[model samples]
Target: MTAPLSEQQLAEIAAREAAASKGPWLEGARRGNVPTLYRPLTSGDGVSTYPSVLFELTSVYGGPGDMAFIAAAREDVPALLAEVERLAARVTELEAEHPSRFAATPAEVDVYLRSILAEDTYLRYQQAIGSEAVREAMDDATAYRNCDDNASKKQAWRSGIDDALGYVDPDGDVGPYPSNLLCSQHNGFGPCPGYPWCTPSQDDTEPGDPS
Candidate 1:
């Protein structure tokens, strides 16, 4: 039997099909057409000769060609939506067997970071950061949304790494670069190229984790 579709395949197919349904509508809507509905009034009351309210209205409530395309789209959109829904359900089902999308709590991030810091090589650190959970902690702008200020953003990410190592390891040895350094205080510099301010604890062995 043919293999069941992968979650990746299902996600790609669902996205493409959904976009296809919108493509024709966008094409028809963007087609250049400026009829009397959009032109300067030759002679009329204020409503006709005034600002772009009429133009905006006509754009939304499109004229003849738009109505025809929309009528056809109305027929196809429901089926397209239904197919998209079905594919979404299938993707959901298949995805259930995969790893849960990781969202790292502070404690979990700490655990992951500390565990790796104890190791001579940060293999675990690199691997874990690539995980959706740690990525959210370290680098995801959407995940760390309040990081509007540059310093806070830098602190947010740097502190995660530091906190992980700052905690004493199982052997009671603090990580090579513990959080006691207050690396955040070192904000104004050419580059933080030393131990506390900048230390390459985690090195990526493969092509997945961010540099």
Candidate 2:
């Protein structure tokens, strides 16, 4: 029986999980772990605050905001793990009471885990949308949508920050937006260069570049 986690513990677990794994989504939540994302990209060089990982746990905090948002959005990890352990414990108790006919295999557990993971993902996404930065950006773009008949306007609010940041896609009018950081070609150490986050000004666009 694991006791409840303190706030610092929660934050630490969240940081460790975000840097490493998909948190409770992939891991059973019963296991708190680290950067599986770093493996394929490095010689076990360990996880830095890579570009992709920032967007994984939550898309809420970006652009000038620090890594704190990742910690806030990590609620899903513990929440998912609690649900998993509670369900598994119940299943075990039931099987114990009726061993002759009752059983819970790992695959069966996985089926339930998948459903729960989906639900948690959705819940976290909604929370990300409601986050302060995202909500504010959406509000900033709301007028554009209100004035235009374009369907893309409806989505403008979410991606409005890209416009504000002057990071328009190649098609400025309609965008999949552009990344804040580009993979630097001049990385000195020769490895992936940490995919370190950069500013709009630091982007690699040249005059001939489509973007």
Residue pairs with backbone atoms closer than 3 Å in model 1 (clashes): none
Clashes of each: 0, 2
- Can you tell me which runs of candidate 1 are displaced by over 4 Å? 1-68, 104-211
CA deviation > 4 Å runs, candidate 2: 1-69, 101-211
Candidate 1 has its poorest 10 consecutive residues by lDDT at 176-185
Candidate 1, 27-131: lDDT as tens digits: 223445432223333235545544543233235445555444445565446655666777788788887766353754444555555555543244334334335
Q: What is the lDDT of residue 120 in candidate 1?
A: 26
- What digit string (tens of lDDT, one per residue) describes model 2 on residues 1-211? 5555568866766565556433232211122332221112222455544545432332222222223434445675666588568778889998787664236543344344435654334333323433544556667776775676776766665467765443222334321122111222434212122222322244565423544
Cα-based lDDT for every prediction: 0.43, 0.43
Count clashing residue pairs in model 1: 0
